[model samples]
Target: MAVYKVYAPPAPPTGGAASPEHFVFVRESFSWAAFLIPLPWMLYRRLWIVLAFYCLAAVAMALLAGSELAPVSMALGVLTPFVLGFEGNALRGWSLDRRGYTLEGVAEGRRRDDAEIRFFTRWVGGHAAAPQQPTPGPAARTLPITTLRETPTGIVGLFPTAGTQT
Candidate 1:
């Protein structure tokens, strides 16, 4: 299954919980297309800051290697694009975070559309009311906390432990 990290606008125009319509599912994996064409993909995604950094870094690398080791620079030139493929989605997510896009959730399916359908279908099933945007409201800094843990014996859900209080 293709894994996707779902992102939604900080504030939906309609207000309420963000619906599937407002979600952007970015595949959580390396991209061959990004590896082959970093600049084009960066431009298409409108990652201006990342693109600027990438361009400057590439140029600097070239200049530093100019009078030194040509092969090292060539290797770096070839390697950076491949690295971009691995990190492109991560960079995009970072950009989204900076732009105030909330990460609603992570989902998976065979195809992109399938992932969307599954996410919404489950969403609707879980909620008694109609779908609402996920935004809590302006001026509120919050995230819909989901499962992520370190301990091996940890449980899921809000009340994971039923142990006695001190």
Candidate 2:
């Protein structure tokens, strides 16, 4: 099979409450190879400059905003790309099926709401399904990973969404 897109249905029971639930169709990226293929080209194009600027901005915002607001500043700075990278290029989900695994890429113009983030859940246990061969299209779309942990809702990222306010 060519691995188009693999997704497992969300858990059926919510503590046996028997309420309605939504299936989260997660689409992980292909591989580092996908990025690696363009690594040399990116370096040649001085893409590092963008990364450097992002780091510099993060630090500047953190310092100027103070620890309390620094995280917010840093988040907003990073989120700009998600909001404006592609069209609205926002990665909807991530996958750990392939040998290298992959995360979704931002859409081509789908902007995110500036409202305070309530929460986000990226993956769920025993429910993670492998995408079909070949993967899905470049478009960013997925079902939704609602039950990521034992908890009903949570967000996944470089850092877990625990201990953070909405």
Candidate lDDT values, in order: 0.79, 0.37
lDDT of 1 at 154: 64
* Strongest candidate by lDDT: 1
Q: Which regions of candidate 2 fall more than 4 Å away from where they truly are?
A: 1-45, 65-68, 71-75, 87-166
Q: What is the per-residue lDDT of model 1 for residues 1-166, given as tens digits with 9 covering 90 to 100? A: 9999888767767767655566678998888878988889999988999999999988877796877777878888888987899999999998898988888777789999888877777665223244467876688877666544544546554666633233
Q: Would you list the clashing residue pairs of candidate 1? A: 16-133, 17-132, 17-133, 17-134, 18-133, 18-134
Error of 1 at 126 (Å): 11
lDDT, candidate 2, residue 157? 57
Lowest lDDT sum, 10 consecutive residues, model 1, at 122-131
Estimate, for each residue in 41-158, the C-alpha lDDT of model 2 and write its tens digit: 3244334544455567657876867667766787876664443233110122222222222332211112222110111132234332343477688695786655556444455555
**How far does residue 135 in candidate 2 sit from its true spot (Å)?**
43
- lDDT of residue 56 for candidate 1: 94
CA lDDT for candidate 1: 0.79
